[model samples]
Target: MTNVIFTVGNDMRADDGAGPFLAALLEADPAAGWEVIDGGASPENHTHRIRALSPKRVVIVDAADMGLAPGEVRRIDEDCVARHFLITTHAIPLNFLIDSLRETVPEIVFLGIQPREIVFMAPMTDDVRRGVAALHRTLVDGVGIDSFPGIAE
Candidate 1:
């Protein structure tokens, strides 16, 4: 089954850039089992491509204000998306986007990296960068998605 990965964030906003940074890294030398998309702030823009891919699973990576230490990575409970985190700055909300995508993708998962700072024109923090690097290695190394921390099987 095909697997798709969507990284969403605003590069202009400090740690929020983690998504695209990781996307670029994965894209440069993509792994065999996944298709990486630099979804940016408007992930909804890629709905067509996702539908076209007919993936069985979709993993979304984004920087969220999850009230955790900076660079901490965890699988956000789908039920808590709206309440506990600062989602994308796009017009469409992340929860709605995920619900809509569920029509095509059977399994949808979210990986959230806590942001140290989201100030405009700032660079990504070292903490978030390290987290991104670690995630990149796990995915590239073919670790099972079930192995992702904080995600309930």
Candidate 2:
């Protein structure tokens, strides 16, 4: 089963760039069974490609306002996604996007990293960078979704 990853964010916005930055890293040295995409701020733009991949697992990494401390990461489950309207800069709402993708992908994982500063022309915060690195490590180690830190229960 192909593993697909979609990183969504706006580089111009500080910590919001986490998705793009991580995408670049994974693209450079992608996992053995993974296809990485930099979905940028509009993940909806890449839905066609995602559908074409016919992946068994789809992982989406994005900065979210989960009311946690800066740099914290959490796995937002489908139920939470349906219940809360997250603040995103995508053309289509995240809930709808994920729901549409769910029809094709067997499993979808939404990794939400708490962003400290999301401002124009600002660099990513140190804490968030560290968090991204940790996430990258976990992916490389092939850890299960249950192993990720701050995962929603």
TM-score against native, each model: 0.93, 0.90
Q: Write down the worst ten-residue block by lDDT for model 1.
A: 144-153
Query: Which prediction has the highest lDDT against the true structure?
Result: 1
Model 2, runs deviating above 4 Å:
82-85, 149-153
Candidate 1 structure quality by residue, lDDT tens digits, 103-130:
9899998888888988899999999999
Q: Tens digits of per-residue lDDT for model 2 on 42-117?
A: 8888989999999999988888888887877788876675355255666777778888898899998898888998
Number of backbone-clashing residue pairs for each candidate, in the order shown:
0, 0
Best by TM-score: 1
RMSD of each: 2.0, 1.9
User: What local distance difference test score does each model get?
Assistant: 0.84, 0.81
Q: Compute the lDDT for candidate 2.
A: 0.81
| Error of model 1, residue 109, in angstroms | 0.1
Off by over 4 Å in 1: 151-153
